[model samples]
Target: MSLLQEADRNHLINEFQALTEPVKLVMFTQEMECQYCRETRMISEEVAELSDKISVEVYDFVRDQEIVEHYNIDKIPAIAIVRGGQKPKDYGIRFYGIPSGYEFSSLIENIMMVSRGESGLSAETKAWAANLQEPVHLQVFVTPTCPYCPQAVIMAHQLAMESEFITADMVEAIEFPQLSNKYQVHGVPRTVINESTHMEGAAPEPILLGKLQEAVA
Candidate 1:
């Protein structure tokens, strides 16, 4: 069964026409695919089928420990958006759970962003990232049902694209209960900066940059 509908596939084909470079969607799953793990892989494969510029690589979370460690992947059903080639170029943009619902848009957008090698961030945000001295990890906790979640996820991902020191992840709260509880993610679109400061709701680029500034300071 196709995870994507006919109309959506057509739309994606047109959207993907803008791609100038190749993209690799490296997905991690175990033998006994965890909750939504199978669907996540299916989604990656389906999306990759839409464009010749895109490809999918599936890896076992347990069996592929070396590649898993290299990518810094610690969980199942994770998707890493990277530039495609013999040597995959990683930008540290990741989806910690299935990029379904609104977050699906985030996945697609990140693919395009990676292909173009541009962050689409404001000048100020780019400037801040250029001077960042410490590594920043952003985990945007979200639910598939949340309409506003993609904005937060996209902004964090843009930061990751802009800075080598910044890594961003979109975490589905329901899919990862322990992680959500650890961060006390009681609200959707909660952006966690450096595992410390957290902001609720879909924050704009300036606010995110300001928060990032605080995290590294």
Candidate 2:
């Protein structure tokens, strides 16, 4: 059976109609013991088929050792979103694990962010993001239907794209429940910066930017 139903496909197509630029989703996987490798690839492919502005490229993790190294990917079922022919200035929002569950919305939001070049950040946040001097790592935990999750993930990803020193990831809450427990993720959209600081919920642009500045400072 097709991964996406016809009605769902049509809805996705309509949703993506606003996309004006190209968004490339590069997925890497191996046919070995990786549990979610196949499913991850399938999700990306199905989503890409919904829009002409979106394209999916699959790479064999084993055969493309160079890509594995170049992208610094250590896990299977990983995805990197690139814009145009260039590697986006952002960290490309790694999906180390499959973005199932609440993370499905994260995937869609990420594609939109890349396509529209828009973020949930304010002017002050944008200014802070532009002047990032040190590397910042953002890990956002989310579920697919969490209405507020995308706001945090988009802000982090935008900063990654705008600054050379930022990398943001939206991790599926269910897939990484252990991580959630470890980080005490009692709610959706819990963002951790540099593995040191954590913020929960959909914080506004200025507040999120302040958290980022605190991480780098």
Candidate 3:
């Protein structure tokens, strides 16, 4: 059975038709003990079929230890979206679970962002990201069902795409219960910055950038 409905498939095809460049989705999964690993891989494959401009590379979470370490992936069912084809650049954008529900929109948005090589950030935010010298990590916690989660995830990815020092991840809260508890993610769209500062909702660009700056400052 297809994971995407026919209407959704058609819409994605239309959306991907505007892709200016190829994009690659690097997925990490293992055959053993990983929940939704199979489904996640399937989702990547299915989405890739929608456009020739999109491709997928699957790596086993256990067997591909070196690659996993290179990507710094701490969990399975993880996906990294980068410029496709040769010499692809990692934007530090990641999805740490199945991009189902509202989060599916996030996957599509990041692909568009990567394909066009555009962050669509504010001028001030872009300038700030360009001058960033230290590393910053952002983890946006979400559930598949959360309507506002995609906005938060997409904003984090925008910063990641703009700044070399930034790495942003969209973590599915329900799948990773222990990690959710670690961050005390009592609500959806909670963004944990550098393990210290945090944002509680789909903040606007300026506010989100402020949180990012606060984390590094």
Candidate 4:
């Protein structure tokens, strides 16, 4: 059976109806002996096919040295989203691991929000978002089995998609145990903003935004 059933496919297609501008998903993978790398490419392509405004571009990590350096992609099987470039640029958003399970939904919604150039934030939050001057790095550590992890990942990804200065990543905690140790991720849905501020569980959008702002401050 496919990962997404008919009902799920229909839901996603319906969701794509809201997108506006163009968005590109850039997949970086090595040609040979890459695990879950092919799956990432396939998932990005399938999702991109759902909407005319979104497209996918695959790059060999081993071959694209300049792009890898430009995007600061230190690892393979990375996926980045640029506004509308076949080649990912300096300020593109990055995903370090496979965004499977609930994270998959987060991925799709991110593309939609970015394409629309809008966020589901209130007027007060929008004002704060408008004032963002510095870059914010959000790392949401998650395990696939955690029921509440998706919420954190979705919120972070949404913020990244909404703001050019914010880049969010849903890090699979199990896949990167060293990251977990480095960040001291003993729980699910633990978000580390800019390597200094950390918050656990799925926080409300406003609260998370405030945390990000404080991290920059």
**Candidate 3 per-residue C-alpha lDDT over 1-217 given as tens digits, one digit per residue, 9 for 90 to 100:** 9898899999999999999889999999886748888888989999999999999999988999999998899998999998977667998999998898899899999999899999998999999999999999999999999999999999999999998899999999999999899999999999999999999999989898888878888
Model 1 collision count: 0
Local accuracy by lDDT, each model:
0.92, 0.79, 0.92, 0.77
- Comparing 1 with 4 on lDDT, the higher-scoring candidate is 1
- Write down the RMSD of all candidates, one decimal each: 1.0, 2.5, 1.0, 2.8
**Pairs that collide, model 1:** none
Residues forming the 10-long window of minimal summed lDDT in candidate 4? 85-94
lDDT of 1 by residue, 134-189 (tens): 89999999999999999999998989988889999999999899998999989999
For every model shown, what is its TM-score relative to the native structure?
A: 0.97, 0.86, 0.97, 0.85
Q: Could you tell me which residue pairs clash in candidate 4?
A: none
Predicted structure 1: lDDT: 0.92
Error of 4 at 120 (Å): 1.5
lDDT of 1 at 167: 92
Model 4, 49-161: lDDT tens digits are 77787888898899989878877787767788766744333234567778787777667767876676666767776667667888888888887677798788767776765
Encode model 2's per-residue lDDT on 1-217: one tens digit a residue. Answer: 5777889789889999988778989899885837778888999999988888888888888999998888777666789887754544334577767877656777788888788777656677667778777778888888777878777777777777676678888777767767889888888889999989989898987778778777777
Candidate 2 Cα misplacement greater than 4 A, ranges: 85-91, 144-147, 177-187
